[model samples]
Target: MAYPQELINEVLDYLDSGHSVREAERRFGVGHESAARWRRLRDGNLRANRPHPVKYPQDTVRLALGLAYGGHGFGLDEVAVMVGVSAPTISNWKRRYVEGGHMDIPEIDLGEIKHLSPDGRARMTDEELEEYIHKLELKAAVLEGTVKVLKAEGIDDLSNDEKAAIVDALPAGFTVTEALPEVGLSSSSYYYCKAKPERPDRYGRARAAIREEFALVGGKRGYRYIRQRLREREDPIVVSGKTVRRLMAEEGCRVSYAKKRRSYSSYAGEISAAPDNLVARDFHAEAPNEKWLTDITQFSIPAGKVYLSPVIDCFDGMPVAWSIGESPNAELANSMLEEACGQLADGEHPVCHSDRGCHYRWPGWIGICAERGIVRSMSRKGCSPDNSACEGFFGRLKNEFFYDRDWEGVTTEDFIGQLEQYMRYYRDERIKESLGWMSPMQYRKSLGLAA
Candidate 1:
């Protein structure tokens, strides 16, 4: 089928970028034949537009016919080579001349036989060519319409009403007669669906509310959280999670995340004594201040590299305290630990888990934890999953905030400020499905654990 020119160009550009046609088809959802044909056309192999050498003298055909009919054991294949025409042409001449009692071989316009038949035959008329291209364009129009309105790949098993809606949404230059069959709808069914009054959208209000919530968070929240917020809003949109998901998708409320990059490591050769893995990858906490996981992640911008160290509570994934600095030194870890320790209630000592990083192994970090009566725990040598909870937090943070952004001209301080702002948003505004669609701060307030 003839894909839209924009999609064709995109696929071609992808191919030109050193990717295979198969890769382009998979990536762009284009058919392999169409992509390969377009590639051929791009490479100056215009098979469709190229002219075939069909010009031959009338005498050459006459000679070829005589050789075929001669009783000298000459076959049609042997005779066709005597002249400059194909075996099929000689056969056509014999059928039209000898069998039909014609005086002479009827002249056929060889130019009209330029296109290859669908069964690999070399005989297709102008009318057949037009019909083939028209069918392709119709199929393409149907595909484009389905993607635009129905958000689907093909019209397989779609209800008549849905198919009719797709037909109605078809672009200009396409007719209902052409689109109806492609979508598997009868003309009468299409007309009947069109004549019926339009059904009211059940999720119209939900769509508007979802758009607002999506924009409020700058499209960082997913549908599950939005569904919860919809139910909790003053004018609640009480709908199922599936309905909310559909509405958000229909409204184009999506968060585009980025691929993960190699994380910045702080593992310097053992600078001080290391503690045992007390948390043991069990990040779940029964109460606040039971376990705290701390890790330092680096963010590189055009201005410079900025480091962030945060002590995340095992309960509700809340960042109890965080410190941002230009360097990931002992002070960065120490200050964050101190701030986190300041929030503990009387006789509350949480196990602060960290990786085997020099900052965490230093005496400064040890002294602060020892004086605060906070327990220290460390992952094994070069084992990150031992501190997987903090690693997970960093993964979420980078995916949601750091990546997918163009930080071309921002200063280090400004980047730090933005990072700090995102952390606040993460704790107070961003909803988590694990927390029943409430932020960490909101979850804390719900439990009367925090103001």
Candidate 2:
């Protein structure tokens, strides 16, 4: 079925704005193949595909209109019969030429004549064949050169500036118009990109500030955090978060970290009677030191295995205290808990939650909590998500720091020192999206809860 030209334009515009063709199908209620064809036609790359309705050449269209308007007063049906088209189609063409202006006429070429069948080329005169072969040579040259410019990706994946590079790289005699069709770029877009260097960069200062912020945090942040940091500056740089993301990609101010899951369980099977699940997967706390989650994660280095026991406050994901040692023993867990309790003021007894790990279930660990009036909470046997807030902290810690580093030949003591430094950095500097892109300490200061 024929769709209205206006509908086609609207769908193509939606596609040009960086949405996928499948999304356009659902949003515009158009068929997927039809929308994709419209996109290719708009990009001027309709080379191998046949036109759906067999579009007649512009010369034939002009001739048909000329005979209809020859002042013989022929009816629409007479013109239709002569041109071998329906009467309504003839009438529509006449209306489009007269009322809508001749410029609105659509010209659909059957691609370059060289792409036609052999018999189709035999019908052409020698001069026409020469012109077709000459055009083919130009297209071949452009395509060959553009391969280097595009690398392994398709031309449509490129930005306008990248496409214009193909146009600019054309041989001296070839014009930008000659190179555009090969690269699926329009003349207007090519010239617009050509003139871009003359225009002052609108995001110059903002790009510098974003890079500084991204580098300030060791490039582990996403764009939202970088944008929040920019806005928080004394002399703020107010820009869209999307703009920050694009600039980050363009300036190479992004981190690449691959995640690998490593599991280490301290569950020694019923060390003692576990406490009730007091937090019950609700990791939120209104005030600092109100709720605490603790867990032990083992990191295997070439030197040896290093274990970390951290007590994380549920309020803002702050690492309240952490102890790194060569072994995952009661000493590591006890020392971390002792340091965490030492920071609490009187009457601030937080619920200490943990998995059914023997370190937390042991008498020494319980005695410290009992002396400090800290309520103990425990997850059910072998359940990780029950104490997931603490598990999530370990996930982030390893993903951002441990997973990507090379720990070859480093002593356990040196590794512990480095881990200590990272703990300090994570607490004081690493921004969290849940805390409005502020570090744990920063968020506390913002709430007037810290010095």
Best by lDDT: 2
Please, what are the lDDT tens digits per residue for candidate 1 over residues 16-119?
Answer: 65456666767899887888888888898856653233234445556666656655455777666545458997777667655757545434343432332244
On TM-score, the leading prediction is 2
Clashes of 1: 0
Give the alpha carbon lDDT tens digit for every residue of 225-246 in model 2: 8888887899888775667889
Model 1 segments beyond 4 Å from truth? 1-158, 161-188, 195-200
Which lDDT value does model 2 have at 150? 72
lDDT of each: 0.79, 0.80
Per-candidate TM equals 0.59, 0.65
Q: What does each candidate score in C-alpha RMSD?
A: 16.7, 10.6
Q: Which ten contiguous residues of candidate 1 have the minimum total lDDT?
A: 113-122
